[model samples]
Target chain A: MLDSEVPQEGNSTLAGHKKAVYARGGDGKMHLVQSAGWEVEEIVTRQAVDDLLRMTEDARRRVEAGQTSALEYHMHRVRMDIPLLAQASGIWQWRIRRHFRPAVFARLSPRLLGRYAEAMGLTVDQLQKTE
Target chain B: MMAFQHSQASHCESGVMASMLRHHGLPLSEPMTFGLASALSFAYLPIVKINGLPLVGYRMPPKFIIKGLQKPLGLKMRFETFRQPAAGVARLNELLDAGQVVGLQTSVFWLPYLPADLRFHFNAHNVLAFGRDRASGDYLLSDPVAETPVSCAPADLQRARFAKGVLAPKGLLYYPVGKPQTPDWQKVLPAAIKKTTRIMLDAPLPIIGVRGIRRLAKAIERLDAKNDAARTKLFIGQVVRMQEEIGTGGGGFRFIYASFLQEAAELLARPALNELAEQLIDIGDEWREFALLTARQIRDRDPLAPAALADKLRLIAEREHGFFHALRRAA
Candidate 1:
């Protein structure tokens, strides 16, 4: 959990780190603080502080760029998250086949890799090696 | 008080159960009541039957082929394929607009292929035309992948797709028209003789060695360094791979696939797999079974939760390395 009251220190929604952010108040529980737009980190983490921090970074980056809305920034974050997602999906595929052997690998097609990549926030390049 | 472990034992037990249920064309949704009965009867015996000359190596379609098709059935007589989640959904919408039924084939890709240390594909496949809300255009789907008929709407569809691209919805648009009818028993078996072994005859069986492992490992390490979302991403990767491995072809693959699907369905029902995994560990086995079965309560409103997915994937990955090591030793 992150502490929002720690102060933004003038980090507008348009600058600095652009991950997601989540916060927890003095009540000892977590809460979402300033969920401006969908940041890469926000979509990944459930904690409010994490979401807040990520969102703050995203907002600050967009704000500095003089962008109109957070949605555009979020879409951009979506692109960056793709490779990570793909890698994650790869890990998941590994778990599914934990008990099997090359037969599964032989059975897996390229299309499945692409879908798996999308789910895990990865790109085809990451999911499938080029060379 | 006791804790339920998602250990290898649970996975194995679940795998064996899945194989038997599938063999009987039974839905894995059977409760512990039946499971306990079977256990007491010691009726869970393995039956091996010899067939024609064993077909050679495994065969898969090209990535282009898998990704090119709008749905899994779209790959009729073709090798495996995949598509971008949004694009896959868009294609699904297109197929549904055309009025067709679909079939989804999902799997865990990694467990079986760990020896090669290469990338694997694992995910669920949902086939059926989209049933949409005429007003909001929210779509609906029916997946023939499970023991029982499974259906979901657009929002849920997107969530599942988001959770892992493993879920492939191949349109068998003509289901309403005429899909050759098979016997009831045939439909229930895991290795549906006709369908499971229908790989292209001329397809090459290449042994994928450790060509990609170094790179995959590096990428995982980088993701781990970020340490924020990497674990989640990596976890999902492992799970997806595991699914693909099971969905592929292996002696024990069907059982493995069944266990994960049961777990995935269970997770899909609860807030998420990790949450349930964490809570189940302290709740003991009986309560855990209830918790697992409660996963069937997945509602249309709940979207596929990726964060929770990542959490579950992480748990799966933590224990997965051992299995991979075992595979390596066997190989």
Candidate 2:
């Protein structure tokens, strides 16, 4: 990686930000060069992010279609799965899976809802109702 | 808090480790810290899933450098993880107030100061939380991957420190405690080089070292056989994201290791090390080429492009195998 070869293609994964990268300078030493971004990096980042967004959108549709509950949508929206949500909230995976059912989720106590909300970095109200 | 310099680095854990050690009066470059820790390696783990995608890491898992340096450098450090979040926060503040710079393992997603595009659920991101901002009273962080030192609100910092999942940080904070005993450079450098060669070439696991790259290459070809364009695209995207998107200093830390080798070449006056460094830079370029080809394959939707991509990786793997073998002999 030469300093001259530092990718400044401007379509980096970091959006507009630049970060330190080591590149060979004219002095034949490694210099900390800030990069504008790379197209290859941008595409991969967008792919991963878009996949998550797609999952969230798919969850939204499933919830609307009554195939799953709002809990499923919110979980994907917050970038978590069953095991992650369980670990974060200290709820069992089985119990969380059970709560994915609309009827069980509807009857949840406020305290339990608060735990899920806190684990996902959402307010309890936000957890209950989706926009 | 103000005692340490905030320097941006291509990678986080090694960068933060270097910063902390430098603040403690040990002068080590980020690349040097990384190489000494033997932190560079490739692992394509299918069993560990992130959002239904296999875990593809450019280097070893996080905190390897921070923990790896302790024994080799004769450094004594205090590491603490709290079951309670408040205790964790309190301990961090106490360390800061004691005029110590602390290294933290945090989740990238909860750190609000980062650009929205860079935030994800990946835990084990490392940063140095030095002290508080004068005006805003936020936790002043020297995030190695960020160009400038940034400030995080207390709430955000707390959330980040304790963010939960696989590799959940659990409010882990660490800092140097006692003065370090320096080791003999002649012995340490060569030993580090040998350890790296062994890891890259001798690790017995099928999913590690040179074998790991080959495993991933074969998996990519197998994935292409499914002829599911979306699935293949996502899997390849995961590889690119791990290699290029994550702060790998380009080519998944290959360039960084090259820099380290270059420095080692000069420090030890080992011309063979210099030769190896050049060889590595070429491999790093090959890795960049791999990324470029994969991107084009995604765009063209050419069915066989992925197998071609896999072929590129296998070539790189064989080159690496040879490189490490030569390195072992050089040491």
Candidate 3:
């Protein structure tokens, strides 16, 4: 149940407005309800997103420093772990692990690269780039 | 394309279903659609991990709402999935050209219009595509989670539809093949309520329903005993995500279920149903409180301890167990 009074304006990451939620009304009917923004829930959601973004950033830094391949970085950016990435690309886990190395990833064929790219929802060129 | 009204809903799948039904001349509220589908449930599968965290689902798996509605209402539905992106887009455009509003299962992370913080790899987000803007080549999207209809570039929409991961959308598209006749509430409402109640109270597996809640509480206690702060935080955070973020209507779908009960009470002219609705609302408040406390613990950087948190969860489980038990008998 939501607060009986209309919620006051508060900061939100949503599209610059409050969203309606259904709540139990006095008449025992469900009514369109509003909130002052779920600040606590928003904070938790942002923290999770920040944790993900940090991982992607770390991956990007590694790729830029030539410590890892762009495929590895893009995998983090798309929020897929190694095993999950392996499954999605339909490549064996050991083979996918090997591709994380810059030299190994660079020597991969275009057809193989295309599979990785398609799995990541990117083009072969985009997959190769650090961004 | 047909002119379809876009209304905001607390959850995506139900909202999309409601909007799609309304477009086909069968108007249904989000809660009503959700309730009729008997979509509510609880599961805590430690073995099923998403992003390396255990899965905690407050409802049945994806497409259950659509499938659930199909059987009871006798709706003829056409479901399509594509192996190629181009074919999927072509098929979607064909449906739009025929003025049919289509329901799409898409990855939330791939939809660029959503706030970045809210974007995750949840692949079962539902939206309706009614038309396309010829000038800009954008698809008119009625994303139920959003406040208003938005347009998505064709490329972005394609990525969302074809995103690969667990529960991949695979460009799944569905539409009702014909108009749905209004259902007989007298016959359907009680049965739907009873079925949902039975599942919640009587599911045999310990990993699901009331037993599942107890199982989660025990797991939380075990996690606390391990004293791994980071792991505990991650586990609790996933629970919050499943409860609040993943279209559970702010309290693990408890409020939505209550809303359904209220509506059912009116339609069936049963005061007892109304009383049950109130009880469900109270249970929903308890769930909300638990979420808030857990959030506070995380935000305040308090050390993870099983005693306090587990106690809270146990109370919730106990209350829900009793409530659902009574609800099952009453229904």
Candidate 4:
């Protein structure tokens, strides 16, 4: 998980592995790297609502040593897997339903339409049928 | 005991009454759902009456499958009494040793909150516990979540991985083969039906409060007396809600129906109430048989979709409802 706190320059220098680095900013937009070992800066934190994308070397070491949950270490990977699994299950459930109910598409039309509208943060009635 | 008054009851109505007898009643009455389940299960496979009646799918997951076919013809499925944490691993080992226990569904058994130190990744569901590797000593299992079959060693299978719950041996839950063309099927059906009916009638109390039926009956009576059509409709909704709670949304329909009967304990006074009770009972009976047949068919076909089975039941319930309404007027 990314922490919001700005990285200390002294700490980055002490790690001894300084190299020009680039990162995606908190705004989900990419940023340019100017100097060696670019740490999460105050400007990034101010621009993004979410915490700055920074996992200090010390925290990384602790997690690698099995001191903390991989839940934090593999947060991004886990988050990516969840939506994929849900989508797969939904497709499978739909296929199975279709096998049993030949008209499953029509049968589930109302329910799916309502769900999708809600998901888009819109009401069901707002979905106009565009022939 | 005075014979239930039949001056107004006709032969057709009496037949309907027999088919619709009140299957469920009160807080502790026999669980109608179990009876329904047993009778239905008995339809497809000759269910060996281990306990009084057979109970299918009414219980929760990681359903235990015991070893060795006890009867030559009948199928026996059991539920283990207690649970242990290392159950998934242990059960996998036992089924491998048995050789006959194929097509298993694996799932995680733990709570949401877990300790940091004791973390293991083994919360898998619908995994088929099939073959095991001899040289590597790895268990060949089907991981439904992955939608593929795989092999995993004991270490790879962790106890703390899934939710936190002890997975112990329940009972042997295997479908037994019954005599293919036995004349005794007729004899067995009634025995299994009666036994299952009694068993279900005996098992529900906790979820459906003791006084649930009484309250429903009161509400129904008030609505009917006031001649308030809308309120009566609302009362029907309340009954449906109560049914859902007691039946676990039809999971425990028999028990819920029984509770309804209990609430209408004084139904002897009103012909209509008495008739409605009977109709519900018959519906439960048919549902039990239908559900079992569906479960059996699905079980026979590997990786059967339960949705298909549920659809079959919806059709059966719809038909039964028609006969039920016809009897309501006479009662």
Candidate 5:
């Protein structure tokens, strides 16, 4: 039977979050036991979040400098890669890459822009804005 | 509507499956549900990148739990994924009006109740929506990963359900379509165990199962001072993320599998499975040790050679390879 003592490492720390672990109860059935947060898990999650924010910040700078379109920035903000963005928007991979360019993105038809916007959960106007 | 009892689970898919089955009057523990589904596996795909790092998975892709349960247990389930968000929301409300608790696939990053640090682009997170308070526009959610039942704003839940990314939820929803017949554990248990063992031991691709572990170890071993520190750290971080953060239960689902084996031992009347379970636990501990060492190296900004890290990983790979091989023979 699995022990009730939760492993000290790599546990999540979301408020009131308990892990349903297995333990041998008095009835000899493997019952679910609740376990609290582990410090290691919290640290790993925090690090991942930090990495994502850093990527988003970099994308924001690129958009500000006119190196990429607002769509590209929003993609990074949502932790998406080019292929994933393309798949989600139902756009061809190469077409999505071209759309990353600000000039090309600006000239996209309303119908095309709508697909990208909806995929990102944003309006067309919001997709056009870097902020 | 069935009164859903929310139990925090170590992993999302298995937890949701267990809870849903129980509500339908099939009282299967999370590990039993996981084992019966044959949900455990390992894959390290170098070509598939997530966040600029190679993808490493400790379990099968999403929806396998739902799919795997069908034949063995004779469960009838309905699953749908929407192209239009509005239609998806309408369908969900329609189901709610009929007093059915619905299972939804959503992106973790878009779920408001998650800590900012725990939020990511993962879109395969599963939750059960039991009811909605019309006045507050908050849906009562039974998120297996959460400590307790939580309330989600309609807008927030909508965004989560339709979040765009790899493995996008696309407003996916599923539920039981009919009552499950009594399962034939005698037939189901052995079949599930054999399939899992075969998949882990005999996958054709080198990037899956025991081969994948070795492949990952070799990749880590190949890292050198020639590689930039940032690149090395990113790779290590991704491994850690796959192993620890992606809901593999503690120790990359090792403990959960051990629990399953312990249970299986009783069910099959095979005490040898209990011995194997303890061995699996030891392998899990080694994985934890590896994570701890890697984390320390990264945090301390230690200038240790990649060879040292590679050595540690190789040891883990060897142990895992041995354990799975023995498990195959024992089964």
Candidate 6:
């Protein structure tokens, strides 16, 4: 891409930061241009962030209705899912999913709760209850 | 102690490797390293899901570049990882004390210096640890994506290096084990160019290379969003995110590859490759256009937008198919 053609439209997703891109200069050689941001980039990034928010909201509703445990709500609230929480905590996915049942989660041992809390960077108290 | 010079580049892994190599007296441009590794390609693996979204990558998997450059360039270097965090940290400090800039694989999420919005659970992000600040005990790092070098606390660096997840680093540390040798550009460039085209054009599965782009287009068109609006948006978002985000440098690495092509042409004294580089630039522009269209569609929420998005991808697939075929011959 030509240096002049590079987009410099700033966006919020980049948090007022710029990144390097290789663009053609007047000398017909490649040079690094600090691009403010691109709207397309912002759109996709916001979509990801917003999708997280959507999941969090849905989890909140499910927890409120008692269809699932606080585990579901707090998981997305901390920006994690079954795979991430499992990986970070070294817990099995099926066990994590099993805990989604309110009864099973309520009866969970303190040891497992400690593991989840550590993985999510939350306290054991915070793990048991939703904010 | 030798000073480690820091330079910004379009991508992280290759940039980190380039800086580390340059510090070791093997001054290589980021594009040169990336091209020599033949790291560029397209893959859409529906089977591999992240956050419930399918995987879409514009390049080969992580570690491909730093490792891929080995055989072709005769870059004999030490690549080691520690099972224990203490051992890894100790070795890193030892290397830094010896004036070695060490390349590290760390999770982007734990790096506090990055803007919070850009921090995610990506575990394969690369950075260079040049030294440690005596006063603060923070590791001085050169994150190529950032405009300037930054510092990270020892604890935070450990946390990032040991972040447990998919593609966990396991404290990966690598540096040049032997002095680098200059490659014969005439022979190496042609081979690299041929390998890249083969990667783009040859894949057993439809979900790889040019075929992968076509599969992605078909998936977009097949998305049934009548009642699942949010999920539909997520799918589209996932597709665009892979190309735009994750430090692709622009047009999902097309621009970077084009730059490499331009350099390769001059290196190999192949004037025809210069024209091919321009051709690739045009193709990269189309990719940008595709991103623009997809983003606008997400905002507009038109019922028929998926078809439009798919049509754009189809065009990109055709263009890439033609470009790779021509590039193979031109190089």
Model 5 ranges off by over 4 Å? A1-36, A61-72, A89-118, A122-131, B301-304
Model 2 achieves a DockQ score of: 0.71
List model 5 lDDT by residue over B1-331, tens digit each: 6677988887889989889888888888889888998988888999877777799888877899888998877998899889888999999988988988889999987788887666777888999998898899799999987778999999899989987767778899999988876677778887887788877888999988878888887897776646576677668767886887745676777778888988888888888888888788777777777777777666755664567777777787778778877877777
DockQ of each: 0.03, 0.71, 0.55, 0.01, 0.41, 0.70
- Interface C-alpha root-mean-square deviation, candidates in order: 19.1, 1.4, 2.0, 29.8, 3.0, 1.2
- Give the candidates in order of TM-score, highest first: 2, 6, 3, 5, 1, 4
**Candidate 5 per-residue lDDT over residues A19-121, each given as its tens digit:** 5555445544445566565565666666777777788888789988989888878887776778778877889888988988999988999999999887777
lDDT of each residue in B1-331, candidate 1, tens digit only: 1111110111222222223233323334222111211210000001210010111111222122123221211223222234555665666566556654333333222222121112123233323333566786654332222222224445445544444332332311122222222223212221221122222111122111121222223333334323344343433233222222212211112222222323333333532322322322222222122212212212113332343333333343333323333322321
Q: DockQ order of candidates, best first?
A: 2, 6, 3, 5, 1, 4
Fnat of model 4, as a fraction: 0.00
All candidates' TM-scores? Answer: 0.28, 0.96, 0.93, 0.27, 0.88, 0.94
Whichever of 4 and 5 has more TM-score, that candidate is: 5
| Model 1 vs. true fold: TM | 0.28
Lowest lDDT 10-residue stretch of candidate 6 chain B: B296-305
Candidate 1 has a DockQ of 0.03
Model 5, residue A108: distance off in Å is 7.2
* TM-score of the first chain in candidate 5 relative to the native first chain: 0.79
lDDT of 3 at B251: 78
How displaced is residue A122 in candidate 1, in Å?
A: 24
Question: B259-321 in candidate 4: lDDT tens per residue?
Answer: 333333342344454454455544554444443343233224323333343444445435433
Each candidate's fnat, listed in order, reads: 0.00, 0.70, 0.48, 0.00, 0.44, 0.68
Please name the candidate that would achieve the greatest DockQ relative to the true structure: 2
State which docking tier applies to candidate 6.
medium
Best by TM-score: 2
State the lDDT of candidate 3 residue by residue for A39-60, as single tens digits: 6567567767777888889989
Alpha carbon lDDT at B321, candidate 3: 83
Stretches off by above 4 angstroms in model 1 are A1-56, A59-74, A77-131, B1-100, B103-127, B130-138, B142-178, B181-331
lDDT tens digits, residues B1-331, model 2? 3466888899998889888888888878999999988888888899999878899887877888887888888887788999999999989988888888888999999998887777888888999988898788799899999888999999999999999888988899988878765667788889988988888888888898999999999999888536588998888888988888857899889999999998888888898898898898889999999998888776665553678988999999999999999999998
- Model 4's lDDT to the true fold? 0.30
